[model samples]
Target: MKVQRHKCMNERCSYDQQERIPFATGSCSYTHRLARYVIDLLKAMGLKDVSGLMDVSWDTIKDIHVRYLERHYSPPSLEGVDCIGIDEFAVKKGHVYKTIVVDLRTGRILYVGNGKGADSLDGFWKMVRKKGVKIKYVATGCMERTGCK
Candidate 1:
């Protein structure tokens, strides 16, 4: 498929139409229907498997999911959050660790940080305060692992 390129008419402006053509799904080769189909398939299949089945690049599948998530969750709202649980999980056996903060009431992840320490929880604390989510209890990980008293 050949897309006609458009050049800027004004002397000051130098914008050209080299970007991807905006399809019915916004700006992708696959249509909105196909994007949804791919997302549906993703629920049961891995990205690589989906890519193989769809005969598209793995990155394209990932891009489709990412765009969909961004569109749906444009701005995160912390409206009725009261209690949140924070814990550290190992990404790889015991070498790598990360912190995850989940809302106890709604079971939604509020924050995830790289290191498993007080610094990791800093962002969650600041965000909850800014959002005015009046948190009551914060259940953290065990003292045996994180040493929290």
Candidate 2:
């Protein structure tokens, strides 16, 4: 068994690093402290525009997203899951669209795609097929105007 230790930064916080050295005079853990530090740096740098700047590339957002996702997105092994719920929503009206699929039983978000068209759903199906998942049913819905089928 493996254990991960996190040091708290807040002086009054109840939790402490049980296995390693405590953080230097802080109440939150090392991870929380690091996040606060990064946010403060970004704010001090006058980075008001988080979406698309010369210095901040898509890769930067993608990296942060992927890292955070690896911590949260857990897809169950395709063994008995047969029912899936699919839906599409736009980032903004008439702008970028994204599709989402959820496992009906586990209530886990399974897939995400960049478009609301049938092509996006097809791409998800292709990936699942390639992975040899036994898909018994797929229920999908779209916006009233998209007419996705």
Candidate 3:
């Protein structure tokens, strides 16, 4: 749709602005309804399939999905958190790995860090110290590697 551009008549304060569309965001090519539909389709389809079905680019569909996730799923609260589980797994075939910290009771992911070792958990430990989180029981996947009994 073509939005009509409005120009201010005042000589001193001349400004041009395009009319805002109620169903769409600023400068975005897709409407809110279309974005919602794409998100719904994503639940039952993959990214490439959704892109092919909607005739939109893969990157655009991924961006829309990411934006929706960011808007709805913020970081989980750390309050009243006691027991947590730490585990690291390779993101791909190579040495690249990621460490994840999850609340044992609620099964909610608390932190994700790059790499897989003691250093990867430094940030989480710092946060726990700052927040005074009294972690009583600790569980890890690599007991032998960490020398934990």
In terms of lDDT, the best-performing candidate is 3
The residue ranges of model 1 lying beyond 4 angstroms of the native Cα positions read: 1-30, 37-63, 72-76, 142-149
TM-score of every model versus the real structure: 0.55, 0.45, 0.55
lDDT of 3 by residue, 3-109 (tens): 89999899988798878999988877889999999999999999999999989999989988998999889776689898888888887795798988999999999
Residue 94 error, candidate 3, Å: 18
Give candidate 3 regions above 4 Å deviation: 7-16, 77-108, 113-117, 125-149
- Model 1: per-residue lDDT, tens digit, 1-149? 77677799999998876445555453467777788899999999999999999899999999988998899876556788777788888887889879887888889887887887877667767787788788777788554443334
Candidate 2 lDDT (Cα, 0 to 1): 0.61
Deviation (Å) of 80 in candidate 1: 1.0
Q: Pick the winner on TM-score between candidates 2 and 3.
A: 3
List model 2 lDDT by residue over 71-128, tens digit each. Answer: 6566545566688887878787759888887889899777787887666777667767
Q: Against the unseen true structure, what C-alpha lDDT does each candidate score?
A: 0.79, 0.61, 0.85
